[model samples]
Target: MTDEEPPAARRGPTWLIVVVVAAALAVCCCSGVIGLTVAGSAGLLGR
Candidate 1:
């Protein structure tokens, strides 16, 4: 039998972790700003 080097394992998730975290933070910040604006506008209009 021939001895061969084992194939290297794939590391797709390690690469994508940074992208996922950044995207999540961006979405959270955008939504929070939008929500605060809407709530503030409604409150001002209600008065």
Candidate 2:
């Protein structure tokens, strides 16, 4: 049998990666805002 390496798998498209990163950032920002609002309302954060 030949001792040759197999071909590597291809990665996803650049646009898809950008969209995923943007979505992740949006979710993170939204969650942070919500958390801060909740904390403020609960008087945990000083005004």
Candidate 3:
């Protein structure tokens, strides 16, 4: 039997996982920025 594996099976779902992780990070960063902006604005108004 040949030891070499097919390319498709060797690289299964790696791209999909990277995309999902990037999307999650993007969402988290956006929310964090928005939350910080709101908090800063509130602080300024209170001062």
Q: For each candidate, what is the lDDT?
A: 0.75, 0.80, 0.82
- List the candidates ranked by TM-score, beginning with the highest: 2, 3, 1
RMSD values for the candidates in order, in angstroms, are 5.4, 6.4, 3.4
lDDT at residue 25 of model 2 (Cα atoms): 100
**Cα misplacement distance, residue 27 of candidate 1 (Å):** 0.4
Q: What is the TM-score of candidate 3? A: 0.67
Candidate 1 backbone collisions, by pair: none
Candidate with the larger TM-score of 1 and 2: 2
Least lDDT summed over 10 consecutive residues: which range in candidate 1?
A: 1-10
TM-score of each: 0.62, 0.71, 0.67
Residue runs of model 1 more than 4 Å from their true location after superposition = 1-12, 44-47
Off by over 4 Å in 3: 1-5, 9-12, 44-47
The total of clashing pairs for model 1 equals: 0
- Residue-level lDDT for 41 in candidate 1: 85
